[model samples]
Target chain A: MPMTRLYVSVLLIAVLLGNNACTHYYYAPNTLQTPFLQEQHDARASLGMISGDEFNGYEVHAAYSPLKHAAVMVNHFQVSSGSGSNVSSSEDSGAGHLTEVALGGYYPVGKYTTFSLFAGWGAGSVSNNFDFDVKADLSFQRRFLQPTVAIRGKWARFGAALRFNQLRYVKGEVDVEVGEPDLTIIRNIERASPLFVPEAGLSCGFGYQAFWADFNLNFCNIRDRDDYHFAYSTVGLSFSCQLDYFWRER
Target chain B: MEKLRIALPLFGLLLLAAACNKKADFNYYYYEPADYALISQHLNLPEIPDDYRAQLPTHIANLGLAARPVEQDKAILGRVLFYDKSLSKDGTISCASCHKQELAFSDNAKVSTGVFNRAGDRNSIALGSVLNFSAYYGTDLFGPSGVPFFWDNRAGTATEQNLASMTNPKEMDMSHSDIVSAVQSKAYYAPLFKMAFGSEQINSERVSDAIAEFVNAIGSYKSKFDKEAEKAIGYNVYSNNEYKSFSGFTAQENAGKNLFLANCASCHSPTQSRPAKMKANNGLDIATTDAGVGGITGVSADQGTFKVPLLRNIEITAPYMHDGRFATLEEVVEHYNSGIQAHPNLSEELRAPGGGPLRLNLSENDKKALVAFLKTLTDTELIADTRFSNPFK
Candidate 1:
């Protein structure tokens, strides 16, 4: 774990990604251990990138395990991809980026192989959307040969995600006059969502990487979240590497 | 930033749990006393001047220990609650609107007027001697072992009495939450509530206690018959011309008394000096607007058993009996002498001896005497007693 390389890697995504690097799992109460299983903790982070002006954005995440195979995390995201180039490039303002606090949990399955299924659920409010919902993200990740100083840059990932958002409202049902009777009702609506949101894609990168990273270009279904039946798929790259100072060999 | 946000919400949860616990405490604190003493406390507790125990002694001994210890503040708060108009839907009428003190704690007229000027179905009973009717023989007249109050005897105790009349559609029609809010918001009610409940917040139980306290305080009896009984009744010699010149009297009032005793006293004993409390089918010529006490208890035996009222103010509070059909005292007495209607459950005491209708051989003179005695039972001190006057005034 080299300080110069980790800093350089972080800076590279922040500056070159054009307002698209995101941080995750900071606000959620990720379980640091599995109560019933051996108190083993698991955490993860991911980054991606791609070539020239096709699509843009980046995401970084972290998690804690407190129960068997489950983790909670808080996340930050900045996505610049859009379905239509006309709407994507012309009307593009930085308003779509969001910073949110959520309570999320996930399960890791299949311990024998390097391959594992990733599934997670969470609820939280995004600064951009006043409403909220139950959200889910699923992915498949695998590390080929264990990273030694020599075989460090070996990894592959495949994943799909489905998320729901909610919106709420309120009304008054009591009279406001004298101690006399009031007759009113308050109405509330919470988290508006488009059911069946889907994100399916994969990434393969090479590197016996220590201060190393990879890029993933995935496809997302906009119609999975709303009624207008919009489609938003992206091809982009992300890079992730171990941070210095916190890096140590046991 | 994530750490700060998470900690803040956890704090909010702790506060919410504490608030919920306080609310639950209130629910648990009420309704549980080691020994049941409140029932008796509420039954005989009074707030006025005394020397007037009347049948209360016998009634209390009969009441004998089936009560819980209601707090003292409960009584004071209850009196104010009983008088406050906020108990009505329109906030226009309180319990006092119908249980006016001058009318022996009863609302006069055939039916009481309620919220929105709606008239009730039957005559309201005098709350005065209501506690006295808490028991019958050895058991309560209301439940399997309780007593009854009101002309219809619908409610069991002063508590039920306070409640039924308050919620009757034509009466107060108050909701519990609304009534609590009303009582809590009044300027003087806060301290009153705190004094009674150790807290100013009003709930249904406290509200019931306050009203019950007021009812408990409003007892009746301190009349001539009562005073006459303390010593030797024959000792207190009568010298008034009304009784002295009894032979020369012409007003049928003199005849009404003798006629009343001979024909009406079988059930209405000389002790009460009123007609019997039996639900006798009076020989009336037409159908009644009310089925009398029978309407409440649903018993065929009670078909016409209107409570034998104390006959305290027969003149001022006119339109007598459960229904206001009789209009005047003359009509009520005349019904007994000749107008009993034919009903299967009519009282045997009402049956004229020797088999036919219990017709009184009252001439016009006798009818007048009976009316006279009925009027004599109307004690002047009671009608004008200032203690029972409108508390608001």
Candidate 2:
């Protein structure tokens, strides 16, 4: 790497290591349904809870399929974690939160046992408030495209996906009010070139009903620069209910 | 049924958000007025009896260098800050880590270690005798001779010197803002700061000033040499060549004292007011890697010159010299005896009649006498003084 890139990588790693709550490693799952030939319109809504070290979150998602081969989806998520304390009081605990909204679509490639491709764009903000009156805010926007393939058996469904993501924008601002004059530090964070992430999971249906629960695990690879890299796995469980309105028979 | 499905998740999310809405209830500026009185008691600061202050020897004052009076409250505050480990970035090192009272406020190690056990380049210098050090250099109580501190003498005053060490990346590894933030975050510092600076607001200047006052207040006059010199007539005189042999000294010690007066008194003056302000190369090495004071001044002629420290507690502050190469007083005396090199910047006092390095040509007996005489300068009372001990329990 060039000297500038090396310096940037060192600084990025230091920042990430210093404020661990800001380094997120999870993204929303895509394409919940297996490919099936149908002429009617269908929509599904899901709510999921995910928990991990330094992270706990809830997500609300809704998807509508206008045609059997195409669907559009929207997801909203809020996550929070404790960043520890620097002061004596229990009230002086440091904490951080992240909120994101994403819009995406998916295309199915087969019937019964099927394959599909999906893409999404997202925007989010992360903020951490520390003891001694220190605060940091980071805003980011990203785009991702992925290819997914799934097989719908009689009782269960299994699927895997690989995503390529590009972070288009990132900005950070830090405020420190401990000293007399107070200070505000701002920086424009450069986005990493691109990242590749792979995810796989299994979903089992309990009964023959529109409502079903599924467990999905996502493996995320995040590299902010040439030398800074972070990887983690996130597991989520969700219950969804689907509704269908027949327009024309297949 | 569809409404319930949408309402359940939203309600759960609302509950989760409510659970996460934790606001810390701490006031950074909270301090009780009563805490001010409790600081000295809790830290066990020694109360300076009026008699102790009055009885302090006037030998330093007799040298035309006025004493820098130390206030009780300011020195107490300084004592706390000096030992507080929070001053460092990692809270693992403090001013006391390298400067221990047992070793005359100097470390026994060849090189002192700082935060993360990182070894510094130069040996730690003793700060215990800085009270007389100021008088020797004819500086104010804060040691601002326009000359610097440390082996390199890079800082102008004691406070500036301390600030440099606190922020040095290899030492405390803290920024100026970091020091202030750490001190302000602690509950104990509020009362101390208010007492020292008339306000609870802590700053770098006040912090350094308090530490400088504390260090400058660490003087020792109860040495064997002081007691013996007090009886000798004209002992307090500052004449260039005036030498009064002490009647109280032993035969061997007096012999060593005479030898020191003839050979070493020019640079390492027996009196408090030393005439030499600039450092000398001392011919420690032919081509010195550590440029000493010359590195700070950027003068090639000043290369290898280092500020000679006062030898008030020479016995306890062993592993002597800037790099701590001499492990014993005997080795130190041997260095000046036959080990002086022909460096271009060697002090003229250490040169022979032919203009090369002077070989003292002392026998083993004379070398022993000089070592014994140097031990007489040790101030046993200063090392065990509770006033300079660590305030923290």
- Provide the lDDT at A25 for model 1: 12
lDDT of 1 by residue, A1-250 (tens): 6998688557545544553322111011111111111112544344543322323444545434434333343334444332212332322211122232323223333331222222222222211111111011111111111000111213433333322221111111111110111011110011122123344444433433333344333443433222221224344444444332144343
Note the Cα lDDT for every prediction shown: 0.44, 0.61
Per-model TM values vs. the true structure = 0.45, 0.53
Winning candidate number (lDDT):
2
lDDT at A109 for candidate 1?
37
Q: Residue B179 deviation, candidate 1, in Å?
A: 2.2
What TM-score number comes out for model 2?
Answer: 0.53
Among residues 3 or more apart in sequence or in different chains, the pairs in candidate 2 whose N, CA or C atoms overlap within 3 Å are: A91-B24, B148-B155
Model 1: lDDT of residue A92: 20
Show where candidate 1 strays beyond 4 Å.
A1-250, B1-75, B129-146, B197-201, B229-231, B234-258, B273-280, B283-289, B296-298, B354-356
